[model samples]
Target: MDIADLTPAERRVWEAFPLGEGVDFREGADDDPAAGASWGPERTVRAEVLRALLLGGPVRDDGIAGLKLWGARITGRLDLKYGTVEHSIRLRSCHFEGAPDLYGARIVALVLNDSVLPGLTAGNLRSEGVVRITCCRIRGPVRLAGAKISSGFFANGARLGSPDETPEEPVLQLNHAEVSTDVWAVGLTVHGQVRMNGATVGGQVNIENAVLSAPGGTALHAETLVVGTDLNARGIHARGRVNLSGARIPRHLSLTRSRLSNPDELALRISSCVIGELWLQEAARIEGTVNFRRAQVDLLHVPPEVWPEHVRIDGLSYRVLAPHRSAEQRLPLLERETEGYLPYSYEQLTAAYRTLGDDAAARTVQLAKLRRHRRTLPRYARLWGYVQDAAVGYGFRPMRAGGWLLLLLCTGTLAFALHHPPALKPSEAPGFNPLFYTLDLLLPIIDFGQESAFAPHGWYQWLSYLLIATGWVLATTIAAGITRSLNRQ
Candidate 1:
């Protein structure tokens, strides 16, 4: 690394490496990488020279030590695979001809903010400090699989994907990576899928206001992810499925005001996840099915109208639901399960209503459950179910049974009052009263003396038989309804 052998651009970097000084080659604020096309070789630095200097290649002893260059044109690949850098590296507003490869490298800190790069490969990389790539416009995939970051990974406002937007692989992937702190990717715009499967984040993963578009494929795939805190993706606009299946977030997962539209497919798949609180309020519009199958959430803040047309809640368990609504308003949510007639879902809805101390709503949900269950029964059994429903509202509405009984009594009284029955035996006959006679016939196991004293004749006998049969049927239905209700409890 002799000064005489160094080129003009290399000489500046060599001179500044000892003291960790920054060199800005741009003439103005708008002098981006595209504007560097007109710049001469004086602003170009070979990647090997920087690599040599970073690996302790004959530098004068100075107090500070880091690489901070801006607006420079990097000529070759900055390959630092399996190497250890003792100092920070900041390459802001720079243009790289090749993607930087830092696979299996251990670096103190790294910053490539506001740079236009082809791509980056930092798989298995271990960084002790923050790795910031904010506002960068990368035209290729950025892989950080198996990486371990101590501070955090910030990629705010970064645009990742190819120019043609037909990436065969994920645009940004950090599978199995461990971040001790937050992963701040707010306002990120990714054209392809962003995968973070099996990753563990000790802090929040804030991707609010981000735009993710992968029409036919998944937009965000974070399966088996474990977030120690909230995953705030509020106001995000995703055109494909945002799958968080098997994730465990111990805090809130806010999707408030987000717009997800993957028609005829899954819009948001959080199946098998264990989340603390899930916020889908503020008119979050989800077009496709939201599968919450087997997910256990502590608190849910989804409005009734925010439910998508299709949902899969086969094993969804939640402790609390916001905006406590009546069964009439919330029962439709359980009805929206694509796989119809899951008794567990109905029971879950009933339990949720009961948790809110709305016993009336809970009973209504149970009644609806019986009605739904009846649809799957045999025709004859369904007819019996209809009888029970009409008689006692399946034991949910006991007052209806009383109303029916009163109506039958009135009908019997009117018919018998107009035409009284003759006494069977004149010597032992009591006084004739049509009301008492009707009561005697209607009461199944009761006698009022008038029924036995005055025996009905002609059509009057047939009317008495009808009344007696009606009374027995009512008694049987009421008893069956009571038993069914007790069993449910």
Candidate 2:
């Protein structure tokens, strides 16, 4: 790695490494590949030459030794696997002949901004400072699996994946990576999956305005991802499912204005996830089913209409629902739960309305729950349910009982007044009032003296028997409904 043996581009990079100054070689080079067919050896530098300088080569110790080359055509693989570099490396607008293999390497910082590469193999990489791959074009997967970065990882506006159809392979993989700070991938475009399963981020994971398309497979699979603060994916358009199952985001999980299009399959899966605030705003559109099974959210900011036709919310719990609506409006959401007859879903909806201090709406939800439960009952049980519903509205409507009682009283009073019953014994009987006589027949538990003294015959006797039967049925149904309401409270 002698300075005399270095090429012209390598010599410039070597001379500029001591003071951490950058060398620019893009003065007359064409940006388009077809037009730049004659990039000669003067603009080319061997990867080993750069690697030798980084590994304490014959450079003067001015205390600012680093590599900051710009627009150089790097030849051969920049293989630094299992190696250590104390200085930061910044290669901007460079074209790598092969992917730089930094597997199990330790470096201070690595910035490959605006670079074009075949792929990257930096799995198990330990970087003390930031790893910035901003605005780059990568033809294959960028693997950072099991990487531990102390600072942050930024890949804003990067286009990743091969032109050949391989949707099953991940374009960007950060599985099990641990980042101390944020992961900013704003406006990123990925042709295959962006898999970050089991990755842990200390700060936010912002992928706003990102476009991911893997039509038959998952677009983004961040299952079991742990984010300390927020996961902001606002305005992201994903063609396949975005699965965040078992993810834990303590602060916010925002998907505002995002479009998830996996029409036949699940568009989004937050199953078993625990989020602080889940924001699925009005503008967000999901073409397929969304599963929130076993997920817990502190605050859910989703409109009723924002939900797709199919949503599985079994065991899903949320403390508060934003922009609250009446129970009538929100009750339909519970019905969208794919699992039929899940009482927990209905109860959760009722509690949400109660938290808003809408007691009437809460009662309405309870009544609806009873009706839904009725559909699963046998024919005989359903008949009893119909009686209870008509008599007392399952205790949700208390006034209905009173109305029925008044109607029965009026029918009996008029019938008895028109045809008075004969007394059992004239000497023992007192002159009977029509209202008291009717009350005696209608009230099975209460005994007015006139009921024992008088004796009805023919049609009058049949009317009395009907009234007694009606009284027992009404009393039983009313008592049952009241007991159910109390139990619910």
Candidate 3:
């Protein structure tokens, strides 16, 4: 069938994700003459599926784009290698017989927005078809990288782990896409974006490395869609936790309302790639930032609800205790990690402490952070005072805080005494002394008794009790905080 007449917007947008092609060989008699010459491309079920897809026969573009595939059985490999299939090419509700390869094919517009790719194997798959299975499920990982499409790629909330030993990475790939405008793929189903090498997008994109990006709007999207800039999404929805520990996104990189649960050694890495800006803090919920180099990470318009919980880092004991690096002073390597928590935002204090070149400072910061979390993890505590030199380090000091508490106590006590002198008569009481002289200099503030101290009165009886209450509160809080500090040491 002929391609549907394209609209101006569709044509322009399609140009960004130019499709590539490659040769694929099905093990037919032609592909391998050793098979008794009986197996041919025509008889193979794989050949039939390919014919249905490319020839616009059974798997027509219109129906596939809208994801209207109900039930159909094809028992072979569907090879759309190097072929450009516009609209949709659905296999929903249908069963496959063997591992398929819709690889190296450029599939624009998807309709699997409510479909599934169940119970089969498509080892190396690449089809950036949009509107994919937001409601469907996948039992295997389908690689859709090396293939570029315009918009509507989903697979959010889809399960992505294989029950077998040879589980594939992320099933989809958007590594290098010729993106001219925005694309929407938030909350769709995906075992994962298996290959995200060099895929670029001009507009905004949605989809968490682990979950969704927004509660209402799509997970990812560009503020202003670019026409020629190819959005390289290689390693975008990578397996495991996303490692952007020290990554520097130049543009608005959002990861809102998403869940990143990968626990691999190097969860995700976005090191040294000069991006526009990372609008994360709020949208990009990560385990934590991994160690990498970065600059100009934008932090605007992030959805506050999806902020990442800082992970307690274990590597580079110095970085943890010393202090954090600034977005400007931090390394340029793209990285992420779920190692540990950072009490303070590293970017906030990087400039002030950069010149110190003190590794212990990093350790100090880390220990102080552990205290805030109250984490008794022996490792977190051990590094605090020993490897980090907790005593000599500049951390939260309870003693210093206690100083303020003492001042407050003293002021309140003095005020109460002045407000009311003792009830004893001066002639019958002890002789005048330094205590009385002290009252003369300070008895007017807070309406303290203006005419007492030496004469002795009864205001002391009532005000004294009030001041005592204030003193107890201040003293108790300070004492508790100080105790915790001492215990840490």
Scored by TM-score, the top model is: 1
lDDT of 2 by residue, 1-489 (tens): 668898877888888888888898886555532222256787888999988988875556665888997777888999999999988999988888889999999999999988888899999999999999998988888999999999999999999985476844688999999999999999999999999999999999999999999886899999999998999999999999899999999999999888889997999999999999999885465789999999999999898878888899999998888778777888887777778888998898888877887778888999999999999999999999998888788777866876787798898899889988999998989997778887887777788787898989998899889888877766666676678668768
- Per-residue CA lDDT of model 1 for 204-249, tens digit only, reads 9999999999997899999999998999999999989999999999
Q: Sorted on lDDT, highest at the top, how do the candidates line up?
A: 1, 2, 3
User: In order, what lDDT does every prediction score?
Assistant: 0.88, 0.87, 0.39
lDDT of 3 by residue, 76-152 (tens): 55566556665445444333444455555555544433223443232233445454555445556555544455454
Badly placed stretches (over 4 Å) of model 1 are: 57-62, 423-430, 440-453, 457-459, 465-489
TM-score ranking of the models:
1, 2, 3
Model 2, stretches more than 4 Å misplaced? 28-38, 162-164, 424-436, 439-454, 465-489
Please state the error at residue 365 of candidate 1 in Å: 1.4
Q: Give the clashing pairs for model 1.
A: none
What is residue 201's positional error in candidate 3, in angstroms? Answer: 1.3
> What TM-score should be assigned to candidate 2?
0.90
In terms of TM-score, which candidate is stronger, 1 or 3?
A: 1
Q: What is the TM-score of each candidate against the true structure?
A: 0.92, 0.90, 0.42
